[model samples]
Target: MEPFVLRGPEATLSTPTPADVDRVAEVCADPEIATWTTVPSPYSRADAEGFVTQMVADGWANDMMFTWAVRPPGEVDGPVLAMMGISRTVGAPGEDQAGEIGYWTAPDARGRGLTTAAARLAADWALDPEGLGLVRLQWQAYVGNWPSRRVAWKLGFRSEGTLRQFGLQRGVLRDSWMASLLPEDPREPVEPWPAEAPRP
Candidate 1:
């Protein structure tokens, strides 16, 4: 699986390089990021280096995960505005394919649609028959993450159901909200936005 870049009208996503290590560490240090994401609480420079130099490289080379560093549209050297990825999983014995999508936006990049744009680019690429050829994409967030839910909703992920203590955050199992998008799904809100999120 060769590393690739995805571009959209509002975002560009490419694999992270060693140069992004500092910014990665800085973003991961955000208290909100630590609370919502599974990144190390006491995230260190070493962790960022591993992510940029090892985890990201291995994930792409092994075809297990395809992660990208999001930036402003067409700005390859711009600051990392967010991070998004798809962790692929083998489906049933004969199923085509499926994967889980995950992402986090940099503090200063929130409130705008950059994160959503990046996600749309990832989803479009991953689900394209001529691209990853995946049949389905799954999105899961801790039950209280309304921001994540809104993004998933805007991507047309149908609210499936909830799994009690099914998602591991940091270490403990927490209740999780689950949703799914298929290749044929429309890229529009599939259901009413959850109450936690203000109506669009």
Candidate 2:
């Protein structure tokens, strides 16, 4: 798939490039991101380069994942505020069409609602017939990741309960919280925020 951009009033989402490696490496060093997401621990410049030249490349070339960096509008190679993507392995002849959303924010970018805005744009596009045409978009995070859970909820993903050792983060099995958003669901909170969620 050709690279594309998603623009919104607050941010512009664009594909990452080699020019972003320094900033990407710097941001991924945040302990919070390493703890909550699958980005490599002790992230390095090499890892950042691999992500852009490899994973990001393969993902788009194969149409299995569509990733975008959240940056201030028009600063394509500037410091990245956050990153997100929708991913899925397309299944056989009659299998269900589904994908999952994933994201992480630069530590300094937290509390700004940037990641939530990015997630909304990606989810809506993935579900629109004019976009990816997916029937379902799922959200999963290791248990205790309240911020991620809150973002999914804010985007109208119905809480689907927890699964034991359901996610692998850097190879270790971890319990996970799961939820899903159907194409027909309203793009607004459908359930009240859980008390455990961090207050805004």
Residue-level lDDT tens digits of model 1 in 132-200: 878999999988888888889888999889999999977799999999999999998868857365566
User: Which stretches in model 2 have alpha-carbon errors above 4 Å?
Assistant: 90-96, 193-195, 198-200
Residue 110 error for model 1, in Å?
0.2
TM-score, cand. 1 vs. native: 0.95
Residue-wise lDDT of candidate 2 within 116-199, one digit each (tens)? 888998998998978887889999999889889878988999988899998999889999998999999998898875726556
Q: Estimate each model's TM-score.
A: 0.95, 0.93
**Top model number, TM-score:** 1
Estimate the lDDT of model 1. Answer: 0.89
> RMSD in angstroms, all models?
2.2, 2.3
Score each candidate by Cα lDDT. 0.89, 0.87
